[model samples]
Target: MSTINTSKRTIGVSFDESGRAHVLLWAPDAKQVELLLSGQDKTVSLTRGESGYWSVETRALQPGDLYYFELDGKKQLPDPASLSQPDDVHGASQALDINRFRWTDENWRHFPLKNYIIYEMHIGTFTPEGTFAAAEKKLDYLVDLGITAVEIMPVAQFPGGRNWGYDGVFPFCVQHSYGGAQGLQSFVNASHAKGLAVVLDVVFNHVGPEGNHLQEFGPYFTEKYHTPWGNAINFDDAWCDGVRRFFVENALMWFRDFHIDALRMDAVHAIKDFSPTHILGEIRQEVDLLIQQTGRKHYLIVELDLNDTRFINPVNKAGYGMDAQWIDEFHHALRVTSGQEKTGYYSDFNAVESLAKSYQDAYVYDGAFSEHRKKYFGMKTENPGEQFVVFSQNHDHVGNRMLGERTSQLVSFEMLKLLAGAVLVSPYLPMLFMGEEYGEKNPFQYFVSHIDPELAEAVRKGRKKEFEAFYMDGEAPDPLAEDTFERSKLQWGLIDQEPHKTLLQFYKELIAIRKMQQPLCVLNRREVSVEHNTEARVIVLRRQHKLQDVICLMNFSKEEQSVDVPVYASHWCKLLGSSDLRWNGLQDIPALVPGELALALPPESITLYSNKHE
Candidate 1:
């Protein structure tokens, strides 16, 4: 067997020991490939190497030079492994020396997965400027809010300025509108300096339709499987080794070149692979190797709709060996309990019992029948609590709606507190969408700026068709309209206002308690127990670690209900009450209580009690 080459990258443009640039392209069917340097009026022929690969080393090309690959001297296209696309996805690719930027995070260490309090933010809507530099200015605020990691939406270069980022075509290039490669590096550096880890969302399932030039190069896509976006990537068919290497190297680029702490893989279920070694497993194997070489911790968290635990299981157990995954069942159950309409996939979950099941078991539908799916779904697993990430509101949950109403607009203030409490108190890792902590009322509507008029119309029609089942009265907002994008921007000023101020304080307190309290901080599934009452619409969750114990009592009903404490402790001290006047609640709850006493819980509120004596 041939040993792997460690001197230079097998794909993309890389600089060797000398200053000369080495270029490699995988075009098996093409007879001749030429490199076109923009503004230099120079073209160099590439030598065809083994496995139909093309390679060339030249001193004429320098860092920051813009170039394109001319296939067979007939059609010109950007490099498939482009490091930067300064003029958007359709234009020329800019050569970038990622090592040129000096990093200041050498001493920074990643936080444990169990201790992660993730804050999900979209660059275009995070602030008024919507650039990486503008977002970096708010790092201190995130630190003050007790966030351990900041999860950014995809920065891959797309067609235009405004997009949700799933439409990205250049997987290796940062969005030019978001300040490009240098902007992201500065943002990550600042985040680490503030003691916050960075998690980048990446799309590997399918490339965006507009500005996609991979098929022009080689068999980069296959018709063997179909995805919601387009044809599946060529991962299992013939000539798949080069395709697999392209993506596997992309993952390594983020960790090795960009110094990213974690990658939140977007929609792994859409990725189809039938090879004996799955693509995810290959990426995991390479990431593990990188971790060993650097002595720095990194994570691969996937967004999967499937409830199968094989993705998170160890490789020895015939699994993909992913570090963690987002639990949509927990969000679905929690949403149903919060009075969301039971339509579409929401029809499968029950109110309080499903939420309880998610708390005890990581999956609510483990080996159970799903009415929405019309089949028995999920496999049971005994994975640790930290392996699952749970959230109340994310980009999909909020942006996919017809009117794009946030939880704050759809629910009451008291119920918001109750929902926030439910997520923070759970055994799994907690995630918060941007402005969710302060209950921002602005909608996170889906928007895009596709350059092609036909493609833009198609996206507008797709958005309308998607929400047809949930809404029928009004027409869905036009995704191409500029105001639609403007409407989605977060109103940072709202944090200083009435209910928003109180809600922000409430979130800070909840996060502080979660970090400081032992029972709440520990991610042990065995030490957690949940009990719910269907008639009263109440859920009582108990978490104990060693001598410390904490109980979270939630009232989902609109009317006040009396609940009996099942614990045997003699004294229980009140830690927080959402119904208290400080949080703008109507009533004042007790500060002290007996363990087995029946207590009156305010309508749509959550109260926390602990055995630790103050």
Candidate 2:
């Protein structure tokens, strides 16, 4: 189905009387136009019409038909087929009937990202099989821990059996090895069955080097801007309208066809778009329109390093209207709280005071000048206390390190318990890396499997060089090693191991308490206040809603420190502490006794307590 250009650069789909597909390719340059089809010699010598145009009408292609066009004499190109590319990298261009696949979640609305908890996992390591169905088995565990959504890492088809899906050339197709098309459907279906919404991480900045065939067809990218990975996508230049539609349609397709609840746009700051209405703004409008028409809740989440709140601000305010965005301040708070000072970015936060500011205000660097960036940052969120996704450990914070050690590896078992308490209780949405609950020991190294040896070597060398000073006492893990991907897999058996099992249990308990306690889930930032000892780097926060009051504390030093209720409360109950040594699973300390219960903060430990009487 195809239609003639209406106005500007717009084209619509159309069908003939017999349901045959017809398209009018606007390119008038070719001396010949051949439709590359499965069994037909579609090399129809097109009649040249007025105004430099060529038109072709073909019998309606089947759903799985791979069709392309040979324009002029030397170009084999994907259809202006008005369908989608299921196999990124232009593998076999597919002619799709949008109505072919029946989606089951008809009455399903997307889960709200606000006050939600997310678990980010990579399909390759989620299970031994590393398929969608294999990962489905773990959905119950996430639900059991009160996680609301499962954000799978990029699933666009990449090379070989495994790689972080970032370097994928195909933005539309599901990864073939990780259960491809059907696997994705099953994964989403199973997740919805368990009441967990699915959020996908999408990369729109640039396609990888291998398998990228868009350039062979048109001006899909431009050198007008640059990104660390490659040339920036041409968003506002010539043929930029086509490139924009390619990605915008891709996003709508994910929600409309696949039932994905939300999308975390990967590193939006890296995406350079200079259009009058930025790409993010257009994507938001298109997504919201689809949601209204379908009556489903769809969220656009930006994983932005820029502290600009306009990304999450409502559309009425001339902002992007994204439902939520990732907040790195919380990560920095937890990072600082544990005395883990790995500088570079850490230079912005060398003191516990910065951590407290983040917890209270939701932005530690809220317009303050920074030494590392040497610039003021983090414009205040007009509406503070919003529930944006905050994490103690994420793929970048871990994988970008010398060795991708999780927060569990960086801090003590006790500190792991403290980190969970602080995040869950804060007035922000909480996120956990796939195995952060049990503290799995695998490192997420930067790995790729491009066919070109030079590109692979460059990636490996680049990673090694970037983290030379950050590596933990040894050489950077070999990015090209078969063992690298293998080692990245989570050890499910760790759930039964000592200390690991205890921490996993601790996570479940903490989440349960958060859901059950009104004050633990406080919704407003102004309602939460922080006071900590500058000398000892000891901290305590009090959160009070209409129903109950909660206190959270952390000791960022080797020696234990004690503090009276930082608030004017005469008596404070110790609801929980990291190093009651009860994290052993054998020891269990009852909720703290009211009336100034003594606190013992261990080295790099965090603790939580409830003001017994609200």
Candidate 3:
């Protein structure tokens, strides 16, 4: 390892005070490196400096100019830190002036993480146009649904037009099919204007197979560990310093340049690092510094499989200091209780008690023996409720299915409303997948365009193999087919239909209740209590904030049941009921209860009641 300058940005192209473009490339193994501009017939040889860094200051190539690096005058590749890939990942890298985009969100400020009601969306399937510009037109729709934040799937450049976005190889470049760099800037600006925070999902575990030129530049992957995708990203290895810088700078680029409110780091359990300073910890430290400098708030949320508190724990406690993480246990337990097949990881959870445990304790498997892995798994976390983002259906939960059937398609209408209540009324932060509010019937199947025939066939075979454990009888949908991606597109026209219209209104009311109700809005696990019955398949949760108290009663059984209620007040006022006729359910349930010992609950329904102070 050699000492390198940390003050200046040396891994990418930057414009200096003299308005000259300074190009930097880290190719320690290559003996020669040359810069090739798109239109110019001549190639400029870069001067190699210390620590295998090559650089050149040029005024000939201006912003928006396409350029490539010719290594050893043999292989010409796009810049690893390309800001714009206008011609897809395999083509030339466009020089983007990030400062050129005039933003109207100067006064916009991010709210607390606890207040976030996230709506996760994939840009391509979010609208018919499948671009950032098209998605911007739906900001008011999100606001009307009471969403405080929008978490977009990975925008990093992949091989072709359509993808779920996890296959992105170019970490810095926005997806060309999604209207590129300028498109994202405008979307973020529009999101901020609509008072919606933009949370960008970023993949740090593995890059996509095709058009991945990181290995060509340096030792970006390690042979020591292997991920499900392929070789794990080289972190805490021989030449890990440069690899660490590459990703850390990528995270900062989203915040500083694109004005992204937060980053949802994808599958962090695959990030193999055994260093003294963990990669996540380092990213958090740098983000904190950026927050202080910009006087704006930013968050780092992780999609982790391991139930480890160290990721969300503060750095002062020798933890990674991630602000929040997605809690899949909640979703698993909720689904299992909703009659999901006890296959794969779902076998680990069985009863309504698991859902109750998730509500009380953040992790249900906190140091418990796991039947899934056949070993003790997870650590207990005394973290606040807001530290966990709970969702009934996300991209992975839906798209990974053999048929990509959403909860809406699998469960009945009443059960859908119950699931919504179970998530929204909980103490944890709530998130909803795109088109889930209106019960869109279209499946969100996994789709990709790899451009390589061999790679495409491999993906098709791999998708079928993944469903082997579930004992799914039919053939899995072809991931490489164009119609697969087309079928996944959300049908906006469905919102105006019979059941869809009612479900959408129900979601609006539910979200409004979550926002306006004091006990529901305030995320405090300590102020919550859970009670359930295994036989009746009923769970009652009580959440309190100061003097406010709200109770959520959920019936997971197929038939109507009655459960004893502990009266803490004179009576319990009905806030919302899934059985209400307004939501297309039978209105047989009462609006108010007068200190009743037992209350009747409709089949597969959830009812909310706030205690009367009198």
Candidate 4:
């Protein structure tokens, strides 16, 4: 519904059923173009069109007016397809009427991406009046902690008002301190009236050098590929089809104007593009024609450190269709089996059988050999497990740590409930960052304000030279400090104390035993299976699904092993344990009898079990 294209070779602020205000701009190296138009003092000129787009219709403009763009009338800027900058990001660009907000989520719908649980917040520290109407007053505490979708993170319009939004630069405005663009269309209509689903997190691979005006609206960037947040977003240049239709119309203006149901994308292997289709397969064939003209459901989910399954494969096989991704090898084999440090790329995840090969393959370097980017990595795809999106405290594994601690400050709340039972009984698609369910002891650091004092001391000497090889306590928090974004917010009064209310009731009893377990809500990776002991550090998995099967066991050791598992057929039962004195643990190992193979395991725990049918 919102690939916003006003019949006049559209580019930015549209309007027309004779209500006027056209305004386009692409700027083929701007020879002239004007608009200024706020409270008008005359300046309207545009007409260049013919493939360099320039437009300008006016009835003195309409929808929320306020404008910019002058170029060659002495360079002004700020409208590389802006929908609303509401003054900042170097000011003016606000004619936002992509059908002005009013969307009571037309019966919202969009679920699948393995029926998401994703939480991943950061609308400025998830709250402390961090706007988007204070994170929609915590969406009923993330739908009472069973969160279905939230994602967020990048909100575009970055620069000042403290960021972490990967320094966004008006990729269709929004973040005028988080409550703009109709406060993200009323936080996606209150997350679709509480059923959830929002996603977002964009950052189209490079465009944040403070208020960057997309190269004055022309060759949209590219000095011949190079990214690390610099250039490389020309996506195959020479007026790259109006910069790939202005980022596939800003990812279909957040699923046709802010009804957003998915878009993670950030860092698609730094989106270089050699053309021949692949602007992420032309944004998945234009969001599959906007989900066949808005029957809803959108999704995209990328974020690649190149374990490439051709970006979630299948677009007639040549790949890049994308529906899911973000598989950091099961959070680097569960943080090197919960004992952390293996150094960069965690030295190819020092085995715990790489967490049973990322639970029977979702990619643990499918191509192998990568002692931290030394070569031969990933590319073996049979993509499943909800096309991969696993997590264990994200925001770049806890704000690219150094001091932004948290895996509950580096392990042990019984290995953070054994890494939340290996990410909610893995079959993929699980995510939780914002205060990780209920253990939020702050520290999601890496804040920013960047009113560029030499880009704020090169982002505080590049985050203390990228965390000077770990071990940080005292000084590293000034990410241009606002008390490091108020010590990275989320201390919602420590969720009623005591192991954060017993890890928020063990993450709401493992998301209510993953929705009353049917092999943990089916995403069928051929009914999964793992089984590893790695010298009694223990691992187990097994799922199944149709008539149920389960089994799960975890224990990444702190000494409490027993092992002998696998025998998922006859009588099992004990569903959900994370070491159980009602989750404050100490032991509660029940049900299991298949030639009674001793199983115990309580130190760093996780249990599960099931059985049924036949």
Best lDDT among the predictions, by candidate number: 1
TM per model? 0.98, 0.89, 0.97, 0.37
Evaluated with TM-score, which candidate comes out highest? 1
Candidate-wise lDDT, in order: 0.91, 0.72, 0.90, 0.80
Q: Candidate 1: deviation at residue 453, Å?
A: 1.2
What is the C-alpha lDDT profile of model 2 across 1-614, one tens digit per residue?
Answer: 11212111122123444656555543444567666664555454445554444665667455566666677778677654234454444445665444344567665555545656789999988787888978888888888878888999998877666688888776767777786666787788778878889999999987877767667555777989988878888898886776776678778877866778889899888888878778898888877777667788788888888888777788789887878778887787668667787567776785678778777777777798988888877787746555477888889888877777777777777667777777787788888998999988887766666656887788789877876876667888877777887888889998998878888878887888777667766567767888878789887777788745787777777676776663544555555656666676223344544456455556655567666555
Provide C-alpha RMSD values for all models, in order.
Answer: 1.5, 4.0, 1.9, 20.4
Residue-level lDDT tens digits of model 1 in 1-614: 21233223557787765878899999999999999999999998899998879999998788999999998879889988898898888899998777778999999988798989999999999999999999999999999999999999999999889999999888888998899888999999999999999999999999999999999988989999999888999999999988988888888888877788999999999999999899999988888877877888899999999999899998999999998999999999999999989888999999999999999998998898888889999988699999999999999999988888899998899999999999999999999999999999899998999999999899889988876865655778999999999999999999999999999999999999999899999999999998999888899999999987898999999999999976766778888999999999989889888767479999999999898833
Question: How many residue pairs clash in all the candidates, one count each?
Answer: 0, 6, 0, 1
Which wins on lDDT, candidate 1 or candidate 4?
1
Ranking 2 against 3 by lDDT, winner: 3
Over 91-204, each residue of candidate 3 has an lDDT whose tens digit, in order, gives: 899887777789999999889999999999999999999999999999999999999999999999999898999999999889988998899999999999999999999999
Model 1 per-residue lDDT at 6? 23
TM-score computed on alpha carbons, candidate 2: 0.89
- lDDT (C-alpha) at residue 399 in model 3: 94
Q: Model 3 residue 190 lDDT? A: 98
- Please write out the lDDT profile of model 4 over residues 1-614, one tens digit for every residue: 33445223256887866778777778887788888876677678888977788886778778877878788889777687786776678887878666655777677777777879888888877889889998897899889888888888888888888888888877877788778878888988988898998888888888788888788667888799988767688888787888888888788877776778889988788788988788888888878876876577687889888887777887898988898888787788888888878776677786578878878887878887787788888877667788788887688878777688877877778888878878888988888888877788778878888886998999898888776655345557778879888988888998888888888888888987886687777878888888887877788888886776777888788888887764745577777778878787886787655543457688778887777542
Evaluation by TM-score, superior candidate among 1 and 2: 1
